[model samples]
Target: MTDAAIAPRRPWAYAIFLVVFGAAGWWAAFQLTLDKFLVLEKGKNAVLNCNISPFVQCGTNLQSWQGSAFGFPNPILGLGGFAAVIAVGVTLLAGARLARWYWWLFNLGVAGALVFTIWLIVQSAFVLGTLCPWCGLVYLVMFPLFWVVTLRNAATGEFGSRLTRIGGILLPYAAPIAIVCLIAVGLIFQLRLDVLHHLAA
Candidate 1:
């Protein structure tokens, strides 16, 4: 079975990355859940701390149907999902070399999250015409988390040799790509909703 206990490449770094990002994501989700409760307890007219401004607040998003896309608060999903992420990271840190199948599943989970996050970004910026700070925090970490997980799997040959080489080549660029995507989202919000103008108002 070889030395499965020792992950081959940059295991510590990846583990730490996952732990940090997962914790951040969980915190954002936790905040959103609290805000959701406040809205529920006090009614829609409630003013949450997350309700920074009309154009940049969690109230609209929290009250929207999209926030309960799965017939429940979406933050609940994050609470569970990010918890799994943290567990995986902790497992890795504990010197467990996960199987290829596990990595594949992890990749799938993160990719699904990234897709969902993108949809929320579009919905928030264009349709809802508001921004949720807590949701933004979730969105912020998701990009890099997905990118790193996918590339790491590829680099480790969980995909194949071709992707392994490509993943290795592209790994260093993951953070940059995520940053660019975030910037693009910010620009979209600014152009479509006049975020700056609203915040300044």
Candidate 2:
């Protein structure tokens, strides 16, 4: 297909991305909130009986403060953030003309979420030494949501021509991949001692 055809069709792709992201975000939000409620209702006993697998147990991870993250519960953030994303997706789908500044703000929010999700993954894998299946669902949903939003921004010319010109076509994929790698490496190193200690114990 010609570039012209591809360019016009790009918005459809972005729309599809947005819908998928919105759905995933909503699902993650639901799971997180449900898990939190379950924790509250059954307390530690609830988690113990939640033996989905050896590796996937909400109870094991709940023993750590990292599970709560916010002193109360981390799912509350997921519930709020994902709800916002859903609203944005609905707006975009309805052909709303979001300002460039608004898109930039959305980009920043997604970036923050992606970073925090990475931290949570690292905390679960190395520090917590146990995984919450619902938390993993959130991480999985977040990875693509981050990519989709950023891709949509670039394709829709939301980042402004100046920044796009500065980085060119490669920036869209290259920058995010670089950031993900940096976070991955940092997490690996950050949890190294903790992992070792857990192993020794």
| lDDT of candidate 1 over 1-201, digit per residue (tens) | 566555365489989999999999999999999999999998887879988788999999989999999999999999999999999999988878778888899899999999999999999988999988899899889998998899879987999788999999999999998899889988988898888887888
Q: After superposition, how far is residue 73 of candidate 2 from its true place, in Å?
A: 1.2
lDDT of 2 by residue, 107-173 (tens): 8998998888888777777776565656656666677677767765675578766655544464457
Using all chains and alpha carbons, the TM-scores for the candidates as numbered come to 0.94, 0.72
Clashing pairs in 1: none
Per-candidate local distance difference test: 0.90, 0.66
Candidate of highest TM-score: 1
Error of 2 at 102 (Å): 0.8
- Residue 194 of candidate 2: its Cα lDDT? 40
Q: Count clashing residue pairs in model 2.
A: 0
What is the model-wide C-alpha lDDT for candidate 2?
Answer: 0.66
| Runs of candidate 1 exceeding 4 Å displacement | 1-10
